[model samples]
Target: MNRIFATSICVILATSAAAAEVELSFYGGVQSAPSSDVSIRDDDSIPDGDFSIAWEGRSLEAPPYYGIRATKWRSPEFGYGLDFTHNKVYPENDELPAGYDVLEFTDGLNTLTVNAYRRWSSAFGEVSPYIGGGVGVSVPYVEVANSDSETFSYQLTGPAATWIAGASYPINDQWSVFGEYKGTFSSNTADLDTGGTLETDIVTNAVNLGLSFNF
Candidate 1:
């Protein structure tokens, strides 16, 4: 009877310790303050009486985003993670007007990014501060409702970069919450065969609210 009681107590302690071995976390909210800027070109040379012309500028606003991250600690202070995120921004108008030309544009900005990052925990309660960057791809779609006489469309997919800084806190043994600010950068260029080519650059600034899990 004594041996049986000792074994039962040992099993309970082992189970409790094992439960702390792994942690899962989740978080969600809103990301405010988003800004974007782009440059567009139709030609570089004058056709008849005109000269070279181009338009480029920047804009700022508050934008929102959501994401999820899973981290598994190989040790206490350091761990590896997988992160996924989504962002959506709409254009103010379907048509963009220039000095002498008008462009019919449809659709906004939509993207999903995935990357791997390293996490670090500090003295703050169950919370930790982390900084990491990864490379991914950006897919942007645009529709031209009226291209002179015919409608035209194209897609942009290329290399992009993601950098984040945020804090995360544990709610329990298996769950936690996180918030971060992320920036994405990319560009696209094309040749039209007529005169000069067209080049478009897009930059997205976003605030991210989401959750983190450890196992």
Candidate 2:
């Protein structure tokens, strides 16, 4: 996964030389996750079981939800970029199996994606509407604890993908403000401290407000 991410960065950098404009953006927002089934495999203390998880996204709490993006525009209508998002999830304790004390990725379910974008001029009066999608990987700070063991560290889990729709209004030729809706899907399989594995597929949705600077 590290190799793939590095390769993507190289590709983005190579493409930048041909770009007509470069834009950097920063955003903060609220995010949420839907309930999903979690699978546990080959564990010593706890019996293996498939359980339903009700996820909570405490976006305003502690670490917070945020994103950064760098785009290389080839023209006014077409572009591509790299986007990094810090998203998190916490399972409702009542939903977990017995003896499981902690199960969450509160630190981050970090996603880094390389995306292609398309924008339309004057889609909403002075605002420009845009859409984008990308493929990447999830590097999450997995946090799991039980009576016999605990696992707390970042791991490269698996494939992740995202789609976004938004509109931006120019404050000036060099600056703009925007709002957007984004959705992401991540498949994670993390190692447990006791030599077991826990797996889950997560779908997250977010609404964001942001500012962008073009150079």
Best by TM-score: 2
**What tens digits encode model 1's per-residue C-alpha lDDT throughout 91-201?**
333224333232211122333344445566666756788776766554443332223322233344456666777877777765677777776565544333333333445
Instruction: For residues 73-102, write the lDDT of model 2, one tens digit per residue.
Output: 878789889887889899854456777888
Instruction: Tell me the whole-model lDDT of each prediction, alpha carbons only.
Output: 0.44, 0.85
* Residue 74 lDDT in candidate 2: 79
Which sections of candidate 1 miss by over 4 Å?
Answer: 1-65, 68-74, 77-82, 92-95, 99-116, 147-156, 189-198
> Candidate 1, which ten residues in sequence have the lowest lDDT sum?
46-55
Clash-forming residue pairs, model 2: none
Instruction: Note each model's CA RMSD in angstroms.
Output: 14.0, 3.4
List TM-score per model, in order.
0.56, 0.89
* Candidate 2 vs. true structure, TM-score: 0.89
